[model samples]
Target: MDIIGFLKSQFLCHLFISYVFIGTGLIINLIQLFTLPLWPLNKQLYRKINCRLAYCVSSQLVMLLEWWSGTDCTLYTDLTNYSKYGKENAIVILNHNFEIDFLCGWNFCERFGLLGSSKVLAKKELSYVPVIGWMWYFLEIVFCKRKWEEDRKTVVQGLQNLRDYPEHFWFLIHCEGTRFTEKKHEISMQVAEAKGLPKLKYHLLPRTKGFAVTVQSLRNVSKKFYTEGRRSMSAVYDSTLNFRNNENPTLLGVLNGKKYHADLYVRRIPLEEIPEDDQECAQWLHKLYQEKDSFQEEYYKTGTYPGTAIVPARRPWTLLNWLFWASLLSYPLCKGLANMISSGSYLTLTVFALLMVIVSVGVRRMIGVTEIDRGSTYGNNENKKKQP
Candidate 1:
């Protein structure tokens, strides 16, 4: 492993990186707040400025994943229609299986020149995550509480706001609502059985209200890109990272936040074909997840997935972005923080520390939930004796 990669693997290195990102993010957010007065006078200009600011912040992490860590991302897709990617607005349906899946999605966005504008229908909790969540707010990214009744109206309204966006965009949606887990999978399979639907070995039950509402809202305004559906979307699927030695591999790599061998299968489905009724849409989504499960099973056994040719991830813009942010914001932000600390503002320091503590606790809780123990420990001898 290289020196940068080695540093990334250490706990101290992760802590340092986290603190720097958090601190830098806090400063950027403060800068954003100062721009609030300008919004009422120039809404469009404010949005455009916000997008540029966000690009500066997020591109750092993307650079860390791509360049510093030397992670390889290969996309599988047909070249015939690749030119149509960012020319039109579309809804992107993706599987929520990995921690850094969003980052990979962003990487694709970067490649297609849509990094600044790509959005997602994320859970409400993510909106509080420092740089990423704050940036999403200005990008018009939709956040859902995940309750169908409560989320339906708000999500649709959010999607509607994107109709007149100045630039082309891709709205990503993880229909599963949360990341995949074995226990969740089992429960979802039970729900499927009760509903008389086929069981899925790879994914959990998809909460279709979000997808249904999104389709309804954007059907007239934009096109649709179903990553795992029939016809190909102009995007490509990059080869992700996977660890073979660990019993349960930590998703985070040294330089890369987390390693995932992502094989995205993108297809462009027309907006009109998406079911109209909620119940029908939900049923269709359930069947789709079942098919995704079968594909995953085939992949695990055969070590390959059915898809088109691979495309290399060559995002030079990511490097340029990192350099720009570090040059423009790094020194000024550091000086500002130093001055504040030296001024002896007790209350401000207390508030900052408290917020950091809360964010740390929340991140820990999320990681814990995603890492629930699922393996069995008892030997089969006892079971065999009891059966006899």
Candidate 2:
């Protein structure tokens, strides 16, 4: 390996990266905390401010995937839809397959200038996690408990509040609700068979109630969200992403300077086409997942999706943001290191070593959140029987 690549593999370099992320992230979180009062004064202005603040924390991960790992995200979309990507509001539907799938999506968000205001329907458990999760609270990210009875009321209320959102944003949803594993797939297919639905090879049966409710909440709003002539959400960006060479990408692999080629296929279906009734909407979502499976299967066979490939350019914002934080934090970090070394006590050294171990475990735990083996068992036979 070359000098830069070798350095990327070093624990010292990893420590520097983690230190910068946590340090800058906590500072951003503090800033977000100050914005809480602004919400009561001017909600729109507060959201705008939080959007930019959230960008600082999220774009660091984008930098790691795009700049450090040199991953390229190729957009397989029509030119017309591509023109409308960052200019309008929409609901984004994505498959939860690989660990780095969300990173790939964020890279697109950065490329198309949607990084700051982008949002997602994430699990409620994530709301309690530090840094990113704290950042999400300020971003107006919708969190669900994965229990329909408990979530139905609150989820609708949460989404309805976005009707008057100032800026254009893509509210992303992982319709499958959890990362795909072979066991989950098997169970999902069993549910499909029990329900008399067609078996899907590349995906799990989509949890439809969430998608149905989201569509219902956002549809046919008589009130105009943007008075300055900006549009409210009017379409669905049905996206399917796959990595070239069948590579199972990971956050750890990206951190270690591995490169990947990601191809994303997005279809801009008008919101009007989706059925309004809950049961019909469920059918529509299942059909959509079936189509997504076909696209994945086709890509595996032909090495491409169903449209012309348009390579999205990497934005410099993520890189620039990282550099700003690194430069600003370096002097204080170096000073602390020097002071610790000057003390030169065995206890201090032992404490430092223990801190390193803690940091290592913390990172692994964070990454474990996306691991298939460590994923939720929300799709088991018992849960399947409870499916509506």
Candidate 3:
């Protein structure tokens, strides 16, 4: 291995990285806590402050995918609406496939200047997790319990709350509701069959009620008050992502500095173009997924989606933000390591070895969290449970 690859493979380097990420994440979360008071005083200023703080936290993961692993994420998009990518509010639809799909999503958000303010309709259980989850609460990321009866009100209120959000953010949605697996796909198609829906070859049936609610809340807003001038329009970023050579990527692969090239095909659709009525909206969403399946089929055959492909300019902010954290957090960690070594003490060295083993296990658990096998059982038997 070369010097860089050898360094990346070192236990000490991984330790330093994990320490910096978790350490700075906790620190930023603490700072986010102080913004609660600012929320009541000046909500917009509070939002702006939280945006930058959230950037400091989320960009680290983006750094892992883009900078450390050196993965290339290319965008295939309409050149006409390309300039407006980072300038407007959008509801982004993404495929839930690979373990590192969200990391790739974060990579695009970083490039588009939306990393700090990107939102997602994540599961409510994630709200309790440390670091990213806690930081997301301040960013106003919408969370759901996956029950239509309970989540309808929560999801509606969440999307409605973003009416006058200060930053141009992307509210990302994975309508499939969980990462794809052969078993999940098997059951998902059974549900699709029960509903008299066509079988999908590439994706599971999309959950539509939350999407319908999101559209009504953000789509038809009456002339709203100004946040960078009052044009009440929200667009849909219909995005389909796939990897080159059909590579199944994982967070572990990324952490170990393995690179994967990703291609994301996006089409910008105006919310006005979609039906406003809930039932109609749901139908529109299902049809959109059908089209998305076709896109995936094309990608599988041609290794490209149908589009005028263009790569957006990569910004240096992710790298810079990571460097800033590493510089700040590494000093104390390295100094202690140096002192421990120079002392020539077995006890301290033994303790360090044990700590490495513990961290290795912790890292494995973290990677396991992103594995497809560990994904939620939301739709695996929903149709059967509803039946006799």
TM-score of 1: 0.76
Q: What is the lDDT of residue 223 in candidate 2?
A: 47
Q: Write model 1 residue lDDT over 70-188, tens digit each, in one string.
A: 55556555565465666767777677665556666677677777777777877688788667787777667889885678987888788777666666677777777666666666666
Candidate 3's displacement at residue 6, Å, is: 3.1
What tens-digit string does per-residue lDDT give for candidate 2 at 267-386? 999999999988999999999999999999889999999888998777789999999999998998778678789999888788778877877776677678767778788566557567
CA lDDT, every model vs. true structure: 0.63, 0.86, 0.85
> Cα deviation of 329 in candidate 3 (Å)?
0.9
**For every model in order, what is the number of clashing pairs?**
11, 0, 0
Per-model root-mean-square deviation over C-alphas: 7.9, 2.2, 2.1
Q: Select the stronger candidate by TM-score from 1 and 3.
A: 3
Q: How well is each residue in 1-388 modelled by candidate 3, as lDDT tens digits?
A: 7898878877677777787888888999999998899988999999999999999988888888887898898899888889899898888899999999888888878888998988999888878888878999988989988878998888889888887787888888888889999999999988888889888888988888888888788775564465444335469999899999979888877887888999999999988899978788888888998999999998999899877877667788888888999899879778879988899799989987887786777677778889999998857457568778
For candidate 2, the lDDT comes to 0.86
Query: Sorted on lDDT, highest at the top, how do the candidates line up?
Result: 2, 3, 1
Supply candidate 3's per-residue lDDT for 367: 82
User: What ranges in model 1 sit over 4 Å off?
Assistant: 1-4, 222-251, 254-261, 327-388
Candidate 3 off by > 4 Å: 227-233, 342-358, 383-388
Question: Per TM-score, what order, best first?
Answer: 2, 3, 1
